[model samples]
Target: MDGLLLEILTAVGFGVLGAVLFSAIGLVSGTDETATIAPVTLLVVMLGAPPAAILTFWMAAAVSKHMTHAVPTALLGIPGDTLAIPLLQQATAMRNLGAPHIALRKMLAGAVISAFIAVPVAVLFAVILAPFGSYITAAAPWIFLIAAVLIAYFSAGRWSAVAGLVPFTLVIVALQAFTGTQDVKLAVSYFLGIAIGPLVAELFSAASPMEARRMNRSEYREMTLAPDVKGWGGYFPNPFRVLDRFQTRATAIAAAISSATFVFSPVAVTVIAGEAVGARVKHAYHRLTSVLAVRNGVTESTYIAEALIPLIAFGLPLSPVAAGPAAPLFNAPPRFTVDAASGEVNNLHNLLSVPEFLLYGLLAVALASLIAYPFAMNYARQAAVFVSRKISHEAIIGTFVGLVLVIGLWEGGLLAVFVILTVGLVGGLLYRVLGMNTGVQFMGYYAAVLSVPALMRLLT
Candidate 1:
């Protein structure tokens, strides 16, 4: 009773704290999930935060970030993050319509509503899948292989993305072999490389005289904000009052469907849910607003669902979100661990039960919705403009790079540094030129370790 009560208090306190931090971070344009959340959660695990607090913090941070993420998306014509990329078209349309304020409101309200709906539904679905956990673990290696191919083929790079996985996988395998011979094994280094690939590539390009010339900018980025408009009279308004019946239905249904599909790429899910909802509506203006709402709602729903379902049902990093930002929750060694040798999960699955997941998960969402929704709703214009003018993308990238370097040094000194640079440069170029994304690269990393070894054993 005492432990459970402690967890409950921890969840409430940290959930709100995470929301407050990431809510502000979300307004900054260049910060994405991998760059922002992954490193933060790693620290949470390393610092020995209890399991319940870590899970709650992860969900709360994601939900809050996605909520305020709409501020930049609608008002300043920039994507809030990877998930916000799909909402750009409709966000741009609404901006042109002189209704970025309405777009921002709808997006926030939609997120709140979908989060409420999705958390309960995702937990229920995860419980249903719980009985099959052993069976899923037995086939985890093969499932990763197939998922890698499918995600690669469906990403923006298409067939090129699929083909690129071949070389990427081989590179991972060779690196593992070399590291193992030296009695060193590194997973975080590989993940950091893939996550920061684009930034590292940009840094490299900026160092070259020829490429730096093309990258030079003469003017500061300019942004125009629509006048603030408020429909509700109170400090915090019910989301239903902000959304119409059709919009509410679309957001709910999309959230429900998205929560069930924790295995696919989140960006793909965002695009599909938006299209699924939008195609049914015919009016251009209504379609624009509703689809944008549904898409942003799907972002929170999918991230929560994807992270929670896999953690609860399988205790594995089965989803892209799980394999990335939430990976440390599943496999941070000496603190939390998922044994690669025996398919044993000794992380959150061992610490928290189903009922606890439901309880803490809801607390996280409620805390986020309570804080982020009202803040973004009230200060969308001011926050967007402030972030546009004050926040430095260079400084954010530099900070993350420094963190990565420190982690690499902690792991294996010069060897780790070499591995990080090699993977970052090669992976960044592939990602930039060939369209292969971090999600695909992550799966490729898993496939190299899991499937390749399994294949070799079978051949032998």
Candidate 2:
């Protein structure tokens, strides 16, 4: 086999391994990207793994975590994290019907199928578009502006969205001015300081005797499978049955488009796109879950595609998530190199060298789905029984919060712990006061970054 083929096979194997390990972790402790996969990516990058290998591992880990997150959301009525929050209602309804296994199976199947279908298409687009990378890079400022405007408009109605632009622009200018100092460490520390500002406020509040209760309490229903379907076979939720009821090509296309466009924040795109698609289709509530499943699949695929396309074609980090994993592919300071003769930017980590990473990543998703399906199916009945007999809904929330705290500490040290608390409080306040989701906050931050050039132009 050629090197590419060998790399593909190796990546697939790694993905399968990641699937089993992450599935077990998700089953016991439901956590999302930050806690479950980000740490691993950071570690692998620190260890000096090849960019292709690191990307392969990142894809495998992501697919594994997402595939298994469905279990808790379906069986326990407890979403793994923010990403799974949108599916909570549908999962609860399925679990109440003793079809938790079937729900999980459908979700896993959808993820696997979509990953397989979407990855290659995305890779092809990235490769074919590689020649035009310079033009794309040159347009980055405009793209960011467009993205920010779109996010603002979609997040709030037209008037409120327009109102939000002022603060967003101000924040970006402030951040850029502070970080543009000549001293590197000082600049980095300043950037980190800005990142942790919310955390500081939270710690002061938490230190007070008045402990803010952040726990969510919901009723847990014990799932009982129909007597006829009791084993591994239960894992294969009749996609045909589900599709017969909810499949609309228009919905799928909408979801896919939303996923493709919103590369910076896939989960937000999935939720908004799912809602839009659901409204357009009949049986909005019933179809919402599947709409989200398709959205989730498409978003993950788009994320990989958009991030990789920019990196391989132009050597630019389009999103924070992409930046984290792709950092190793280029040497420490990733840069764009233009060919003098043709003025074409060449990303050393182009599809010619990196296609195998995506191929293997999809293979891992397939393997994970296959293995996890049977186990999840069998466990669904047991999980229902166990929860009925032993677990309390409140206890699960407590455990999840504890896990989040530990993960926060791991990611940002004491600083991260503080930041999470701040983010939660501020995030909650933003929701309560401004009626904004975390997505809006993210948009504000990115928009802030793009505001620098506009400010500079005005000053000049």
Candidate 3:
């Protein structure tokens, strides 16, 4: 037991170190999830690290990545990942106003504040709901179905929601069918890339036309603290001034509710629930920022909570985000499976265990904030100057494209390269010509899932 505790602590230290290193990389390179966290975690796991260490490292990397990755999104027009897209409009606005620091401060502050609020809430929910584990397990399929429906409905809307449903169902069916015949595991990332490849390509193409206009000749800057820097004192805009910015009960309630549910994707929650809360507030900017922050908090919290719920309850991975990190922790396959006859899945690995994962997540959040806050507050100007001088957005984009190509090759061999190009063309047309959110492609992914099952049923 003592050894277990020691291992957990060691893992936490490793996590903090990994996060800081990744955060620095994210700031300079504008690379996100795939570039930063996945490879690092995979490497650690391959080294046969203890489960606790791996979990701590995974959560730490995730939390830390968000803290620093938001910098490019908030300061420049470039988004770090799909998760950071919601902040693009607001962050770009701030950047144009030469107050990119404001956007950075808001994102960093909100992340820290949300992490503080969310960790305890998640822990409480996990403890209270632990007793009903079996019941939750029994209802897993129904829960997933409902979650899928809700995500679809909210993402597309009621009338057009069917479009969303069809695609999701098709994807699942296709996946299941393909899995039965041939292994789809090797192609998962490639397929995911194909589904979203067009969107990425479109983004690059769109930026290409304006790239010359947006290029910065300045050097990149490092965040530095003012001589008067203090602990939490530096977090506020004004030390003595308390901004009632996020003081409303409704915002808190919405954030808490979203955190508890953990059903929809972060983007879905931000668009649906975030908009709903924004409509309720008085000041438009205040409401928008507050709701955005709340939504972001809920997204992060729910992601953490939902991952644990499945593992603690039925021992299944409920979401890809969870499975990605959890895979290394348990040394489990990237995919989960159930027996046909018993319909049961084995989830008995106890590497980091449930409580430890929860604690480590909390600790990572706290430690990341403690480190990031001062850097953001005091060194905003320096960081901005340094980044502008040292890094070129064009270089960043080239690096991203190269990485995507490598990932494509890794997933589907050379065939994925053509897949990416085809998708990129379509995505570019949809975004530039139609002005639609790229998320609509998610419908195609779902459709692929559903088609397989329907076909099987018909044939059988």
On lDDT, the candidate that comes out on top is: 1
Better of 1 and 2 by lDDT: 1
Assess every candidate by TM-score. 0.95, 0.66, 0.66
**Per-residue lDDT tens digits of candidate 2, residues 228-264?**
2443444555443434344434334543454345245
On residues 234-298, what C-alpha lDDT tens digit does candidate 3 reach at each position?
A: 34343112224553343355556656765455566655666776677787567645654555555
Q: After superposition, how far is residue 145 of candidate 1 from its true place, in Å?
A: 1.3
The clash count for each model shown is 0, 1, 40
- lDDT agreement of model 2 with the native: 0.51
TM match of model 2 to true structure = 0.66
- Runs of candidate 1 with Cα error greater than 4 angstroms are none
Candidate 1 lDDT tens digits, 1-460: 9976876898787888889999999998757797678767877877888888998898899999999999889888889888899998999888888888888888999999999888899999999999999988777777778888888887778999999998999998999899999998887778778777788788888889989778999998676666666556777867897889999998999999999999888998999998888899999989998998899999988898988898889887788888776777777776776655556778998899898888888998899988999999888888987877776777777787788789788777778877888788888888889898877887788788777877677799
Top candidate by TM-score: 1
Per-model root-mean-square deviation over C-alphas:
1.8, 6.6, 6.7
